[model samples]
Each structure stands twice: as structure tokens, then as C-alpha cells.
Target: MIKFFRKIRQNLLSEGKTAKYFKYAMGEIILVVIGILIALQINNWNEEKKYQKQLHIKVHSILGDIREDALQIKALLKDLEKQHSAADHIIPIMESEQKAIVDSLKFILDFNSFTTTPILSQQNNTWDYLSANGILSELEDQELVNLLMNYYNYFDELTINFNNSANPVRLELRELKYELFTNTEHRKFFPTKKPSVPSKAVYESIFNDIRILPLCRYIGSTAAYFEGRFKDVDQKAEKIIYYLETNYQPI
Candidate 1:
């Protein structure tokens, strides 16, 4: 094509047709400009396609991370509720006449420790990477970003606080309960399938103990807070999942 154009220009110039040569040169210039414009347009399209592909990969990774977190948190949430149930049993028995029952004390011995807590698994790497590198915005889902922030920042911190607070308090409760009961009674309560009756005075001592009640209150409130936060996280995860399943796709 270049040679063809060159020959035509040479013939026109050699014939001294300067006007036609100028017109042909101008036509050639226009064609070159059009070609450049087309090249630039194609480059821009390729860049956009690459951007979309990257966003799709990041979004898919994030969805997978959240789904795992959701599964783990579901079990953790149930565990928190179970702890609450344990607290529920202990508190009522202590507050009521049933405190003297051997079964009640056995239940207390089984469930009174705050050592058991929900173990939450977080899928933070995906979120942290996308966020720190500033790729999270590539997906253009501001709502999803905010929800993730809430989970990682606020909700994760809530879980940490709940666990940290329980640790020292659990030790204190264990010490106090041992102090309130005889070694024989405490040991007997544990291995006994059917808890045998301890003296009413033993029950009264535990019930009237100032230390025990505070520990109970702490356990109850903490369990309640944990349960609520678990539910809140569940809802947040579900919403993101819904958005992903409903609206999610390769960009």
C-alpha cells in the first residue's frame, strides 16, 4: 500500500500536476490520522477489558472468602447461643428454690465455666489485600465495600472484646466457685452421672455468695451481647451473599 501511494505521488509530481499531488498528499494525511485514531480507540477498549477482568477476579475471590466466613460464623453463633442457654439454666436455678437440687448444681458445675467461647474464623486476607492495594473500588460496589468494612472493623473488634473480657472473668469465677464449695463436692459433681444431693447449706452458700452473682451477671450479659453480634454479622453476610448471587457476575 505504501509503495502504491508512493508511485502515484511520484507520477503526479513528475507530470507537474502539483494540485493533484497536493490533494493526494492531503488525502494520505487524513488516512494516517484516521488510522492513528482507530489504533488509539482499540487500545482504550483493550485497557477497559483488562480492567473489567481484574475486577471480576477480585469480586469472585471476595465472595468466596465471605462464604467461608459465613459458614464458620454460623457455627460460632450457635455456640454463643448454647453458652447463653447454659447461663440461662444456671442463673434461674440459683435465683429460685431449685438451687438446692443436686441436678441443678451438677448443671452449674458443667456449664458455669466461661472457658468455652465461640471460635470465629475470619476471611480477612482477601478483604485486606483488595483494600490496601486500592483494588476494592474496582468492582464499583460501594455498598459491598461498606458492608465489608463493618464486618472487618466493627464486628471483628466486637468479637475480640467479647473474648478478652471473658478470659480474666472466667478465671475469677472458677476461683470463686471453688472457694464456695468443698473439694469433695466439686469433684463429686463432675464425674457423677446423676448428681447426688449435697447439703442445702452448700447450695445456700453458693447462692448467697456475692462473687458468684456478679460472675453470673457478667456471663449472661456477655453471652447476650455475643449472640446479638453474631446475629448482626449473619445478617450482614447474608445481604452481601444475596447481592453476590443476585447481581454478581464477571464484569
Candidate 2:
């Protein structure tokens, strides 16, 4: 093509039709500029297609991560519900005159509930990768980006609250166990060890302690709060997943 254009230009110059040559030269320059622009536009289109393909892959990965996060949140919610149930049972039993008559094994199990702390384990590896590489900005759907940000931010807040507030209450309850319960009673907390049934006196001591009831209430409240937050996060993840699956198609 270059050789063809060069031959045309040489012929125009040799003919010495000066005005016609200038016009022809200008037309050739215009055609070359048009061709360069067309090539550049094609290149831009290819680059855009490549970027969208990569973005779709990343979005698919994010959807998987969110689905896994939802599962983790579901499991954590179940554990929290158990803890809450334990608290409810222990509180009523302690308040009742039949506290001593309550099954020793059941009472010990409920008492041991405070020792278990449910922590949120978020599946955010892909999110972190996108953020670190500044690829989040490349996402065209700002709404989806916002949803993702909110979902991950909720996890951050949950972690902060657990560490700063809920965890301390749980730790205090655990320490109280050491001060209030005998070694035999403590061993009941572990299911593998078949400890002797705790004495009525042990139940009496636990029930009579001023610290136990309030601490149990605190633990119960924390569990309930975490359960609610986990549910919200699960719902948000579902929404984001649905949006990505429905709207995004790779080039």
C-alpha cells in the first residue's frame, strides 16, 4: 500500500501540473490521516474488549467470594444462635428456685457457652486484590462497587466491635469461670472429658454470684447483635451476587 501511494505521488510530481500535484498531495495526506485515525479507533476498541473480558473474570471471582462469605456468615449465625439459646436457658434457670435441681450436665453446658466466641471470617481476598491494584475504579457499575464496599465495610465494623467491646465481655465471663467454678466443673466445659456431675453446691455458687447474670446478659446481647449483622451481610452479598450474575457479560 505504501509503495502504491509512493508511485502515485511520483507520477503527480513528474507531470509538473503544479496546482493539480498540490491538490493530489493534500488529498493523499488527508487519506493517510484518515487511515491512521481508523487504525487508532480499532486499537482502542480491542483494548476496551480486552479490559471488559478481564473485568468480567474478576467480577465472577468476586461473586464466588461473596457466596463463600455468605456461607461463612450463615455458619457463624448458627453458632451465635446456640450461644444465645444457652444464655436464655442459663438466665431463666438461675432466676428459678429449681436452679439446683436443673440437670448438672445441661447447666454446665450452658455455662460453658460463654467460653465460645463466634468470630466473622470474611472471604475478601479478591476484594483486597482489586483494591490494591486500583481495578475497582475500572468497574463501570458504580452501584455494584458501592454494594461491595458496603459489604466489606460491614465486616470491618463487626470485627472492630467484637475486638473492642464484645470480646472483652466474653473474656471477663471466662475469667469469672476460673474464679467461681471448681476443676471438675471446668472439665465439663470440654466434651471429650467425662467429668463427674457438678455438685448442687456448684450450681448454688454460680447462681448466687452477682457477676454471672449480668455477664450472661452481655454475652447474649453481643451474640444477638452479631447474628443480626451477619444476616445483613449475607443479604447484601446475595444482592451483589444477583446483580453481577444478571448484568455482567464478558466480551
Candidate 3:
């Protein structure tokens, strides 16, 4: 193609048609520019297609994360509901100083399932992409961003509060070690390998021992609060699923 154009220019110049040669040269430059522009436009189109494909994959991965998160939240919700019920039963009995309440304490103690590591792991990085990269602006539903924002705020607060206040049950447990272990009657609860060795002050304190009803109630209330939060999360998750289905393509 270059040789054809160069030959035409040489023929025009050899015939002393200087003005005509200049005109032809300008026309050739225009054609070259048009070709370059067309090539650039095609390149851009191909790049956009690739980007859209990658974006679809990213959205699908995030959708999977959200689905798994919903399942985890469901499990936590079920556990919380059960804990709330058990606490309700035990709270009343605790007031009456029933020995059965002692066994019920184990229910609360055994309630731990997913550690903090897994809870944080469930939070998808898509939220960060939306916030940091303005990706959420591209989402068809702005409400999806709002839903995720609300979830982030709620979970942040809940995790902070829980981390700060979670150990009261463990703290109240020290009293059991000090006071109850000394009681010869309670010795059956302790293993013989680690004999009960309460000090005389511990023994003397039992007569004046105060119940930890407040602590137990507080723990139960905290569990119930977390349960309510998870219920809200579950609802938001449904909305997220709807958003994904409506706006995002699986491919």
C-alpha cells in the first residue's frame, strides 16, 4: 500500500504537477489518519469487551461470597435463637438459685462456633471496591450500595461492642472456681486429678456468696442483640441477591 502511494506521488512530481502532487500527498495523509483512527477505535472496542467479561466474573465471585455469607448468618441466627430461649429459661431459674442453672451455664459457654477470623472472612472485598474505586456507581441499583453500607456500619459497631464486652462470663467464672470448688458437696463436679483447693477465705465467703444473676442476664441480652442484628443482615442479604439477579450477568 505504501509503495502504491509513493509511485503515485513520484508520477505527479515528474510531470511537474507540483500543486496536484501536494493535493494528493495531503489526501494520502488524511487517509492514513482515518485508518489509524479506525484501528484505534477497534482496539478500544476489544478492550472494553474484555473488561466487561472480567467484570462479570468479579460480580459472580462477589455473589458467591454473599451467598456463603447468608448461610453463615443463618446458622448464627439459629444458634442465637436457641441461646435466647435457653437464657430465658435459665434467667428465671437463676433468680430462684436453682442448681440447674449451674448446668445451664455450660449452654452459654458451649455456644461459641465461628471465631472472629471466619466472621471477618465472610465480608466480601466488593464493598471495598465500591467504596474505594467508585465501582458501586456503576451498579443499576443505588440501593444496593446503601444496603451494603448499612451492613458494614452495623457489623462494625456490633463487632466492636462484642469484643469489648464479651468476656464478662469468663470473669464471673472466677467466682465459681473460688467459691463453689471449696464446697465438699460440689467436689463431685471437679476432677479428682485437680483437687479442689479453696482457701479458708473462699470457704468463709460461701455463706455470704452473692449470685451472679446480673452477669448472666447481661450475657443473654448481648446474645439476643446479636441475634437481632443477624436477622437484619439476613434480610439485607435477600435484597443483595435480588440486586445481583436483576443487574448482573453470570457470564
Top candidate (lDDT): 2
* lDDT by residue for model 2 (126-227), tens: 899999999999988899999989988887787677778887888888787788877766665565565556676677778889988888888888888877
Which portions of model 1 show Cα errors greater than 4 Å? 95-98, 102-106, 109-113, 171-211
lDDT of 1 at 25: 98
| lDDT scores of the candidates, listed in order | 0.75, 0.80, 0.62
Residue pairs clashing in model 3 are none
User: Candidate 1, after superposition: displacement of residue 75 in Å?
Assistant: 1.6
* TM-score of every model versus the real structure: 0.77, 0.84, 0.70
Ranking by lDDT: 2, 1, 3
Worst 10 residues of 3 by lDDT: 109-118
Clash pairs detected, candidate 1: none
lDDT (Cα, 0-100) at 115 in candidate 2: 73
